[model samples]
Target: MHESLFSYINQNAASPLTSDEEALIMASFQPKKYRKKQYFLQEGDVCKYVGFIVKGAMRQYSVDDKGAEHIVNLFLENWWVSDRESAVMLTPSRYNIDTWEDTELLVATVADMVDLIGKIPLFGQMTRLMDQRSFIASQRRLNSTISNTADKRYEEFADNHPKFIQRFPQHIIASYLGITKDTLSRVRKQAMKK
Candidate 1:
């Protein structure tokens, strides 16, 4: 259960927190369950909490004026999900987050994060590192989308997340890849044949 979170924290965060600091952060965190199709954060709403998935899948997406959904990110077991724009700016979100499956999450409110940084400065360093890592990953994604071919995108995605290929449905994979379902099917077939 929380062993995953502990491992994640230990991996990303160095310099252990003081007992008081750890307790404060833990106090503000509460576990919540979301069912399939549930909306965690809708576009235009302020995101109040950052969540770590205990189990299940969630997608952060944007919808165009034409009512098309473009997946910006996908999170599954042991992943964190948040509307980064709103979280960083403390403003309404442009992304909508929803459960792609029944999900269990450990949620830490924004207030707690502020307090954590104030009490445990090392946590701040940990957070900065995580943010930088996320930025680099996003930049790589943009590069892949713009500079790489569609087949390359599929190959890269598969290489990065073999578990996702087996866990997520094909349609969702297509959404994450910025491709049509049919194209994803073909690309996957070609990749497997090779």
Candidate 2:
């Protein structure tokens, strides 16, 4: 069950971890499962765990004042999903994280993370890299939303996450790209012609 997690850790680590270190890391995580549409974190609740997706898909989103949902990102296999600020600060999260499909996750609490970092120093480095990469990705997404045309945004999102285009429904993809469903359909048709 932890095979995917172990491989992901080893592949992303600066150097190979010893068997004992791998065991220690694995021991720190606990498994959880969510059925489709089940929530891992909800708005106004403190996010207590950082989850690594073992299978299926999850989405991070927020409801606006008008009661509409805006998708922030989709979390897929081998990805980490969390309201980072809330998880780290023990504050209530503004976002809700829920499964798009039945999902298996290996999750760690902040205390568990702290213990792992203290015991396995290399994990600290790996986490730093993870944070940096997450920040860069967030920046790119924000830039795309602000500066690109809807069609351009859809195209970039499709190119960057082709797997998501295939995995998620059109409406979900439209929300993630901050476009209307009609606009997404139009964009897809236009792309096909080009």
Query: Which ten-residue region of model 1 has the weakest summed lDDT?
Result: 1-10
Q: Show how many residue pairs clash in every candidate, following the order shown.
A: 0, 0
Error of 2 at 65 (Å): 2.4
Candidate 1, residues 15-36, lDDT tens digits: the string is 6656666566567667899999
Candidate 2 lDDT, 42-93, residue by residue in tens: 9999987888999999999999999989998898999998898898888899
Lowest summed lDDT over 10 consecutive residues: which window, candidate 2?
Answer: 8-17
Q: Which pairs of residues have clashing backbones in candidate 2? A: none
Which runs of model 1 end up more than 4 angstroms from their true locations?
Answer: 17-19
Cα RMSD of all models vs. native, in order, equals 1.7, 1.2
Give candidate 1's root-mean-square deviation (CA, Å): 1.7
Candidate 2 Cα outliers beyond 4 Å, as residue runs:
none
